[model samples]
Target: MAGVSRYLAQSIVGTLRQDPTLNPLATLRAWPNLPAEALKRLNQADLSLVDRALEQGGWIWEPTDYPDNLREMESPPLCLFGRGDASALSTPMVAIVGTRKASSYGLAVAEFFGKGLAEQGFIVLSGGALGIDAQAHKGALAAGGRTVAVMGTGPDVAYPAVHKGMFAQMEASGGARVSPFPFGTPSFPSNFPARNPLIAGLAQAVVLVEAPAQSGALQTVAAALDLGRDVFVVPGPITSPAFRGSHGLIRDGATLVEHPMQVVEALGGGMIQPLPPEEGDDLSETQQAILACLNGGPMLTEAIVRQTGLSAPLVLAELTMMELDGIVKKGRDGYQRGL
Candidate 1:
């Protein structure tokens, strides 16, 4: 199907905008690497359906409008479509993402950080899903700050239907709802999995408040890591399955921050920002040893005490506090790390 890859072809077209002498469609047809069969098919293709789809769309982003950070990706969306202020992309952005079925604790954290980040003047970016994503967008709006909702469906289409009013409010309030999909694209479940990275790619950093092991929010982490974006995780209750993936991120050496100011100051102030003492910054030597034991996998109390050469009473006490902090969990089989 490819004499030239879709990405390379799109990149060529995007760059061609700067050249007055070249026509984009003609350049595509003339390229020696463009497959002959593909060109023939495109020529034979009907234009009516394409015209119908464009009617459902809104403003289309010219190549010049693509954010530098996003354009740096191995593969970026060919074009962006949206309503309202696409100018929000020019500002620094921070993504706040989590499970759509977030718990009360997750929702509260998202709200707190969303408002806090926006108040600090960074645009809050998130996938426009319900639960944590919606709450974060609302919190930013409530603080009179700008936010961007990156949607899986078409930019002008509201997928949840319930949030149509909220989307309208966002558009009117200087924020935006945007998508990579065309104007008439459907909100099929498959569309969402690919949308998570757009949230991460647009932002300088990503903050994950909560997610289960299988949460699509984790997809952002993978993309962020690849893009060299720093990821910050908020610790949640170990008893809840909602935080399993979140805690896993923390254990994987992602920074664990308890407040939005930590992220704001860290990003804006760089090394000069003397962050206040947070729980994660003060791990005791005993706690370190205990974590080392559990890092391999779940183990019984006897195994932990034996492995660390610590008395049962001390190990038991440390485990109790760690469990309370949601750093670890105890199951019927053994004590292990938790969300």
Candidate 2:
């Protein structure tokens, strides 16, 4: 079995070196000792059919180099089908994963980590699943920082399909969509468990925002433990089933993370200077007005309009611009100072 593991690992590395378009996991799962029975029950399928479907979807496969560091991670995916520059994968990254059915609190925590990590110069990683994962990716990209989506399905096909535009936007903004499965690989239940390890391997740590007792997100926590990487969980309402798995992990010894700073402190001594306080780009007058409105705590757009004397339309436009500039965030009721 050790021989099989080593060979399987080597096979992926070798495949990545040759066919840049190849997704090692999809093809390599065919090997003799790949825990196929378990994965098969999970409904995993090969990518041969997926490749053809993507051709009709107008997707293109582009090869990019993986950093020597990433290639050296324990059993890294054979190759990743990337929608943008693969180099973004090499950035210091932290994985933020959680339940698909998330509470409002859980979603907020995910976004906090996303924006915080991006500001701290850490690339954010997530599965691009709905709920928590989606919020995290949105926050990171909103921070104007690098983010990578590791898919359980093919990079060409957004699994939920609802995230299709988000995926394209990420790629266009120098962020990337990556997969260990070939194009058109329908997101099988089985594919995600296998995909968990890849996410754990890519990150320095895995953060479980909110996981139900039987959630697949737990698989990632387990993989992180196996890989000797740190695992962190945000404390949620004790009564919430969404927090059951995470609480179990904490009881078993995962770090309890509340603020995003805790994560940064865990990664290194402390957060490095995140995105510079200000980029060289000059702020527009309207953007300046909006920032002025957020003098202290989170502020609503109505308050901003009243304070800035700007119309709602003008205030909203400036707010969007500030969000893209990484200056502000939309909170539960309104906008707030973002990381």
The TM-score that candidate 2 achieves is 0.66
Model 1 spans > 4 angstroms off: 1-57, 270-339
lDDT string for model 1 (1-339, tens) is 224576776778666866868865566667666677658744644435445545643577865688899887777777787878878888999999999998766776787778778878889999878999998998798778998999998776787888888888887878888887656566767678877778878989999999999999999988999999989999988898889999999999999988778898779643332333344456679987888888778999999999999988778767755664466789997898765
TM of each candidate vs. truth? 0.67, 0.66
Can you write out model 2's per-residue Cα lDDT over 238-311, one digit (the tens) per residue?
88887899999999989998767788898785744435246324666777677777767788878888988888
- The candidate that wins on lDDT is 1
> Where does the lowest 10-residue lDDT sum fall in candidate 2?
55-64
- RMSD of every candidate to native, in Å, equals 12.2, 8.3
